[model samples]
Target chain A: MSTAVLGAMYEGIKHIFKHTFTMKYPYQKVLLPKGFRGRHLLYMDKCTGCGICAWICPERCISMVPVTDNKEYPQNPEKRFPQYWYARCCFCHFCTEYCPTGALDYTPDYELAEYDRELLLWSPERLSRPPTNIGEYQSVFHGKDGNQGVTFEPVIKQKSK
Target chain B: MTTEPPSPGISISKTAEPSTLDVSVGPQHPGSGHCRILIRVDGDYIVSADPDIGYVHRGCEKIAEYRNYVSNIPHLERPNIADAIHLNWGYVLPIEELQGVVVPPRGKYISTIAAEMNRIMSHLYGLAIMQGVFSGHTTIFMWAFGDRDLFIELAEMLTGARLTYSFLVPGGPRRDLPFGFEDRLSRLLDYFEKRLVEYDRIFFSNPSVIARAKGIGVLKREDAKKLGVVGPVLRASGVKYDVRKVEPYGAYADLEFDIPTFEEGDSYSRYLIRFEEMKQSVRIIRQALEKIPKGPIARKAPLVAPEGEATGRVESSRGEITYLVMGDNSDKPSRVKIMNGSFRNLIALPFLVRNVHVADMPIIYGSLDYWPVEADR
Candidate 1:
């Protein structure tokens, strides 16, 4: 009986010294894959107003509108397009995949927790721009010379302490 | 494969024979899709199994005669929802090759990456179903399905659709990655890797589960060769014949990952192989995400409406999905024939199940991850 009690006590003490596998994720961010799916960015300038993305959407989250960029250039048919609210985005990367000029793109930021719905509504400004010093191909369809508008994805640099 | 079913069999004397039972598993079985098997059993063991297929048959080939080439894309997607990228590429590849559509390097990379993710989910679904059969734990199914949402969400963000995404055209994919896609995908990958450990803890490492699976329904490499079972099952049986390896598609040649194998060919070996495959899939997806070149998701469809017949053979979740499409230069397909792996497995089930006890039926059947609707089609 004494040996059994001592064994239990020893096991408990040993357990206390063991390392924990769980990480405090919310408090401290975990390492992410280099290419993860996140939110959508629609580059209004590069958008051709083609409805293929919307038509191909399985979830029916994407929609097109006649909103004006700065409400200027009313006569330019190409100037008006919809402001995609990515809060409902499925992140299939359809817009980015369908963009003719390589304008639409996917970047590695996936966190979309928000306090308000209004913040989710993004138009041209929300569309991704080319990364610094990356190559860009200028063509109707994203071409071989670094797809029309796709900017180079830089190697992920760890945050400095 | 079973002796061609002996035509006009002569009956044996009933007075001297033991009693045999007739059991019919349906085109409507909850565990299965559209294939029905009528099994002849003597006491606890199955004697002969007759497979009745075409339950979910939508004559894609017949319909293709009226529709145009562009319209057949959705029809192709109906066969396998788990590995949609493979199907997408399968259909696009022939067109790309034939029409002189040299997709940008970025396009090939995206196809390769997306297909690997789809393959992971497909294999996960296969393993989950097997787990459900061996033990009544649907937890892995829920987990696998839940994680599938991540890939679905990823695909949706990329192509604007979850299941029937027409994102991959002949030239290339439809769009580029969404802004901040990497951040979310990175986090998701971490989450997926973490879940993989949990899967190992709960499903793969469970002793009772292992006992139930270890040596059941084994297929010898020789027999598998004769039967022509594809995908991980054949690989699990010590055969290293993968469509990706045999005929390198998209950017598969460029990516680095192992095609996991096991020589046992038992149910346990298959389960383990699939689990390892999930890990490899993560590796492949990570590589694609990291090295995905900045480029156009797709090239323009080189040949606009044309009369052509193209066979899109893809490696689906089940195994090899052969999509035969014919076009008449219109916007739609002239004919489409979707041949799925589940049908092939269903055909060979009786051969595998012969003399096995009734208790082992679910484990044996579920281990194959046969999708009925796909088979019926």
Candidate 2:
């Protein structure tokens, strides 16, 4: 009985020497792996103004709206583009897959917090531009054998797709 | 002030010796998740435990009726967030049967890997919650959560998302295995195996946990079968009835892994069963990764299905999750019924809590691995 107690205490003390598994947010951020489904990045040039993304959305979060200033394309005369209400979007990336023209893609920018509810809505113009100044730290495993711990390693150069 | 009269067939009586007090443990308490348990206690011993479920009911079945079959994947998986892919598979399996879409061998293999990964993740989540419930040991809770992230990372690499994969579609998974997935998975699994040893030493084999858990809320094998408890809780009672073995689905048919069972039906046995099952899950995953065939992940499935009702059953991290889907000629399903393990296991709660001490409430309740949101849905 005493040995069991001592063994448990020893295990607890052992973890103290091991590196913590937590990420210190803001100062040090772990880089998300490739193909992480996050916010949508729309390619307006590739888009034929098709409403497939809006139609296929499970949450009904995307809607097609008219963009008057866009350059005219032979395939699309309506000049309608998708405007996403991020408040309702589940980020399932079904919209990205079903878009036939390869117009939609997901960026690894998941940190989309806002003080106001209305600011959560991303317009066609906003969705067209990719997120910047993100993802530098890569999660690296520290320790040998079965007693392993996770730590973040900072990347020297920025990653580009 | 006015007092209401008693209803018919009910009598209020003051006992001769001592009064039985009623204690309500949340629809909002930290220990009980989203559901309330009203316990009638005679001094320290509990007379009865009435589980008040449905605190987080979202009417997922009723809502599935309105949405199209393809779009309902996200809504159906919300019931159990930790094991979303299993729920997704259960809902999608019937639709795939109705639509006449046969998943390729590779697709089956991929789905099996994802299911096993989610099983480990779900069990770890359950263990973390169990630690919080019975022992309030933050060490185990934190360690479990931290270790769970490893599997979640592997899952995120395979499927795009971290938590709600929605990776399982009608016919097969949405994506194929990513590059270098096998090597990373093997490394993580090795680390997890070592972590399991630490878990046994620190939490399971700890003297305090053994003292609190052993011989408390003991359910016999006959009583377990009689109560129809599901998942690890049932296996702990030595039932040996797993849906993976009984009606094999996906890649589980080809897999060679044993269903771990314990003769004793106490809380410790239930915890041990889950611990053993995690090891089994690791074994199954490694086998799947090695033997996966090269082929197309999915066969094209139509949005609409023929008029027929089909049921799909898969062993979820909880237990057997069965989905009965009735499809008309339209794009949307006519009716969808999801029967998960949490509600079935909930039947044993009142039965097991009887004649046990009040302190043993968390042990019995947490041991069942009951998720109120899943039960209510």
Which structure among the candidates has the greatest DockQ? 2
lDDT of 2 by residue, A1-161 (tens): 99999999999999888887777888887677778999999888788887888888998999998886847756667878899999999999999989999999978899898999999989888999988847677666776854557766796675887
The digit string of per-residue lDDT tens for model 1 on B113-200 reads 6777777767766766655534676666665765665666676666665566666777777667778667666666776776676677
In order of listing, the candidates' clash counts read: 69, 0
Interface RMSD of 1: 13.7
DockQ of each: 0.04, 0.74
What lDDT does the true structure give each of the candidates?
0.64, 0.87
Q: After superposition, how far is residue B306 of candidate 2 from its true place, in Å?
A: 0.5
Report model 1's chain A TM-score: 0.53
- Provide the global lDDT of candidate 2 against the true structure: 0.87
Q: After superposition, how far is residue B76 of candidate 1 from its true place, in Å?
A: 1.6
